[model samples]
Target chain A: MVIAAIGIAAAAALWRRDGAPAVGAALYHAWELFLFIAPSLLAGLLLAAALRQLVSPGALARWMGAESGWFGLAVATLAGALTPGGPMAAFPLVLVLAGAGADRGALVAYILSWALNGFQKLLVYEMPLLGPDFAIMRTLVTLPMPMIAGYIARRLPIAWEPPK
Target chain B: MTGGQVFLAVIALVAFGFCLRRGPGSARRAVVDTGQGLWKILPIFAVALPMAAFLAELIPADAAVAWIGPESGVSGVVVASFAGGLMPGGPFVTFPLVLAFAKAGAGVPQMAALITGWSIFALHRIITWEYPILGWRFVAIRLIAAAPLPIVAGLLAEAVVAVLPIGLGRP
Candidate 1:
């Protein structure tokens, strides 16, 4: 809602500043982007949905249920990148992992991995919007982050309790 | 369509085939899920693209370059990372805004830092999603552990761009 309002305001401002022609040009460019991106966006979403079905929550819990060491962290990170969708899809899996006895480090890795470079976001947004070069570079740079953070998180004195 | 688009379509098809093996029911569900997801986000896309375009127009390219261009270096990356953490909303909102910044001449490394910051430690997500569900103890540890990631990612991206023979940071 707020985003819509802000967008409207921006459009209005642009119109006022440079008249209809500038606004028209902006719209034209936006339209062009939309056209160029629409096919990939639809394919990416379909791919995400299909992949989600393939990796069921129960399977995910079983895979990460045990092991709190570096291997566990690596698996957790891979799972996070593979898990599709936004927070609504990913966070519940975190809950499931916690419930299934995944450690704090693994959980942290999962969240960080998803947040940083979840395949769904990469395919749907980054690749189409920023191009493959940018996406691949960003992914490579941040790829090690989840494990590194998870390793540190594992050493923390904090205790873990699954959310009720 | 570009090679990327073709690649995406081929992957989607292969995945759909796998889902079909699971059962026609599962295959249908995947399509239904995609439809629903598209319905939800299409409006955001419509708004975001125009908003990005207008904002790109509104913010002068010279200012963007001065603040986050290739010449701006580590300090610029640090500033971008901080700004990224403060950005609100989801991918729909953030990615379009990033695109706008890119169009306005933000550097690749700076944009990388911005995205890493947004992903790693988005304050809004932590408040709305993490703190409430995961509790403060978990949040504290996670934040401390991940704190340096954005800047690190930025610097790493810069180094990669420098080292690679291919032009890796153009976007």
Candidate 2:
């Protein structure tokens, strides 16, 4: 937060030096973007929270545990993609899954899926800003990443353990 | 409102309804969580949107085209990927910058690479969120395992564009 504040302050100073009109333009653009995204952001958070309540850790673990194999990876990937919120919402659920005995591979896959192709972000932000074509193309290109990464993580010689 | 916003609103309404049916406690929890998430995200947006506006105003379309435009090719993708990792903030900030760059004439492949790199190697996310929550070992392994992804995706996107240029819908 502090860093963001400092950045804004610095940018404001730079824009002010550039011209009063520039400052006004920048502020106007920011306000417009905020208004555009505010509803989606709020809805996304609510959806994420609701999901957290709906899906139990036991179910998450069962669906994405070590013994669940490729199916587990698929489930993890889908769950990660479907999850609606940011890292704060996703990571705690991950921690819970880890505690409930999800494998290292599943965990890694879950994180990668969320990072690369989170459905909520794609729908709310990416598609909206970048256009549906760009969003779809990117999604197609990235579809395999989480699974590939998960497979590699599973096969790596390193002794991978769940985060303590 | 955009189609995406309408879609999100529907999802939110359904989720809220479900939570409400589950219990008042659940609905309250959702509200509290939403508040916290908003708090975390707004500051980043506050800074990033202005930065994007500034970039949009300052950078020329031709310069952006020369650097990360289609003619710039693989090198442009590499540079974009690196920039994406270094960029701080969440999607609210990152997407607008990409939009700015696109409007300034960045190629689709470069944009793809940028988004990929931002997703995987964002230093802010790695340091502030992933490490603290998942621990160093997991983070390291995941980083190493996924290192080649953005570049590969970028290259593939470039190839796809060459074969079926219309499919990518390049700006």
Top candidate on lDDT is 1
lDDT of 2 by residue, A19-53 (tens): 77876776787677667667666766666666666
lDDT of each: 0.84, 0.76
In the order shown, the candidates' Cα RMSDs to the true structure are 2.3, 4.2
Model 2: residues with Cα > 4 Å off, grouped in runs: A1-18, A35-46, A49-53, A56-58, A82-95, A119-137, B20-44, B127-137, B155-171
List where candidate 1 sits over 4 angstroms from the true fold. Answer: A62-67, B163-171
Model 1 global lDDT (CA atoms, 0 to 1): 0.84
What docking tier does model 1 reach? medium
Which window of 10 residues has the lowest lDDT sum in candidate 1 chain B? B162-171
Task: Write candidate 1's Cα lDDT for A66-157 as tens digits.
Answer: 36577888888888899887788888778888888787888889999999989889877877777666787899899989999999998888
Candidate 2 colliding pairs: none
DockQ of each: 0.64, 0.45
Per-residue lDDT value at A109 in model 1: 91
